[model samples]
Target: MATTRVVLITGTSSGIGLAAAVAAARAGHHVVATMRDTGRADALRAAAAEAGVAERVEVARLDVTDTASVTECLDAVLARHGRLDAVVNNAGAGYVGTVEQDGLDPVRATMEVNFFGVVDVTRAALPHLRASGGRVITVTSVGGVVGQPFNEAYCAAKFAVEGFMESLAPVAASVGVHVGVVEPGAVASEFIGNQGIDLPALLDAAGPYAPALKAYVDRTLAAFGQAQTPQEAAEPIVEALTAEHPPFRVQTSDRARAFVGTKLADLDGSVVQHLTGSWVA
Candidate 1:
């Protein structure tokens, strides 16, 4: 933020991504906000305009799941900006179901978007980031630390992302690139609300998992009711970007910190099982 670096962020169509892009722009940085569909960029563009940071924000098309798309966006960013300071890997999707009911197909699909997508974007952006001695800030979830019921695929992908970044952070630091992960708890966004689920149909087809799934759904919905706004969640991301020496891992809120802390100290694993088990009870 002090130097006004050129920052590139993915998945800026809505929610935290949009808020992050706008917030970064408002901080006097050049923000290239990329999303899968540029047609859905009205909200981000409008927010930039409203914040009076429209000139600092540029919207681009990027599909993180596609290697070519990732390559093209990075290439374009360099060709236009001449240097890349930071990359925020925020593009991702969510899935809600157990492996037995969803099969391997949804699991693989979710991994493509949530896990491999982050890898693709980060891989493409690293060389440019290295040249500028920049940073890589990824938006992972608390699920990355603590597994939950009825979210096997989603948790697995986030866990993979966390592992990947944790392994890469030190190696990246050796070359002047700083890497950090932001873990957010429940965020009250369309991404949380619009999971494309049909409750009655899914429950009716759930077989023995129906009652547990129903309980999980009820608890999840209630928790999301108190979810933080996208703006509040985006604050940590900006902190990771601008802090003099950003921590490797940052939680968006105290609740998120405690949630991940529970996993960190669960040496026997019993504590986690006992805690998450009650979600489906």
Candidate 2:
């Protein structure tokens, strides 16, 4: 029988976080499923009830952007569970716009939730995780490796996370703590819709980049049509949490693997630039 570990996951109000929380509970782990607003956790609650894991899943409020909230949530989980086992850093935000259009504030905002959020949560959990020899799994994106057109800010954040995790994994392993990242491709979820991007407005404001932006949108949407579901995307996360020796990185789908592979195979950045440039041109 698998040991019942205590797991904390962020952004459980919807999408991948919610799915991973429910799935982790179903696997006999005590799950602390957190969202920025617990008031919006109806869907997560319903899903837990349906999965018959309601008793094992506890919902908490954790706004990763706030350092205090990150500490508070981690402290609460430790107080309740007596020990921390694993943390899934799944909370993230997306931004879509050319570098010039995004400006500094939006770029910083993207980094706050997607990159710094992970850093804060991981830092808060590290001591406990070290004590338990636990795991740290973060949900990054395929864009982390391959910069997509008009997704500069989002990709930059994810790229930062991937680099951070890759560097931390070895140091973490030395302390008997495991760290890894799950990179998912275009998953069919509210992630895109929740980015708060006003597509029509953005297009109207794009000016010189309008045509390329439209093409990127069309291509991205078409790819999303064949993307994995939230549940499917959560599988790799679960595996990362439970596997005896989880991989340092796991791409959730073959498409994600292929997307990331392109960058990995490129030696002088010429091929990647050619391909990515085509998206905007």
Candidate 3:
């Protein structure tokens, strides 16, 4: 049997976070499932109960964008559990649109949630992680490797997370803390469901970018039609948490590996540019 661990996962109200939390608990680990709103935890609770790991799953409220909340949540976890062996930084918001069309505020909001939120949580968790020689696993996306059309802000934030984790991994390892980033491609989950985007209204206000936006949305819809389930995408995150020596980077699926591989091997960047470029054209 795998050794039991105390794991804390953020954004567990839905999607990869929810899946990872339950999967971790089911794997004989104690899971602290946190969401911004505790009231929205019914689905997660139901899943955990059905999986027979409900008692091992503790639901908490944590708004990652707030520093006080991050500190408070971690403190409560330590107080309640005495130790946190792993942390899954899976809370994120998705965005669609160009920088010029949405202006800076929307981009800033995306960074605040997707990028800064991860940074704050990771930073806050590092001390505890180092103490326990724990692991930090973050669910970034293939967008982090291959920038997608109509996802400038989202990609930028993911890219920042990739860079941040990549840089910190080595330094963190020196203190016996393992760090890894999980890259999933086209996950069929409700990340931007919270974004409240109106497709018709978005295109109506596109101005000069309407054609590209329309094409991009059409292609994205088809891609998501065959996207991996949240459970599938969440697997790699759990692996990183449980592995004795997880690598700094991990792609969740074959499609994700191939997609991220293109960007990794592209010397002049023409191949990926042409590939993603076609989706918009």
Q: Estimate the TM-score of every prediction.
A: 0.98, 0.97, 0.97
Where does candidate 3 clash, by residue pair? Answer: none
Tens digit of lDDT per residue, candidate 3, span 168-268? 99999999999889999988889757778999999999999999899999998899899999999988888888777778899999999999999999999
Error of 3 at 215 (Å): 0.5
lDDT of 1 by residue, 41-143 (tens): 9999899999999999999999999999989988888888788999999998988888887789999999999999999999988998899999999999999
Query: lDDT of candidate 1?
Result: 0.93
Ten-residue stretch with the least lDDT total in model 3:
1-10
Number of the candidate with higher lDDT, 1 or 2: 1
RMSD of each: 1.5, 1.6, 1.6
Alpha-carbon error at 63 in model 1, in Å? Answer: 0.2
Worst 10 residues of 2 by lDDT: 1-10
Error of 1 at 53 (Å): 0.7
| Least well predicted 10-residue stretch by lDDT in candidate 1 | 190-199
Report every candidate's CA lDDT: 0.93, 0.91, 0.91
- Superposed by TM-score, candidate 2 places the C-alpha of residue 38 at a distance from the truth, in angstroms, of 0.6
TM-score of 3: 0.97
Q: Please identify model 3 stretches exceeding 4 Å from their true place.
A: 1-4
For residues 30-92, what per-residue lDDT tens digits would candidate 2 score against the true structure? Answer: 999999999999999999999999998999999999999998988887777788999999999
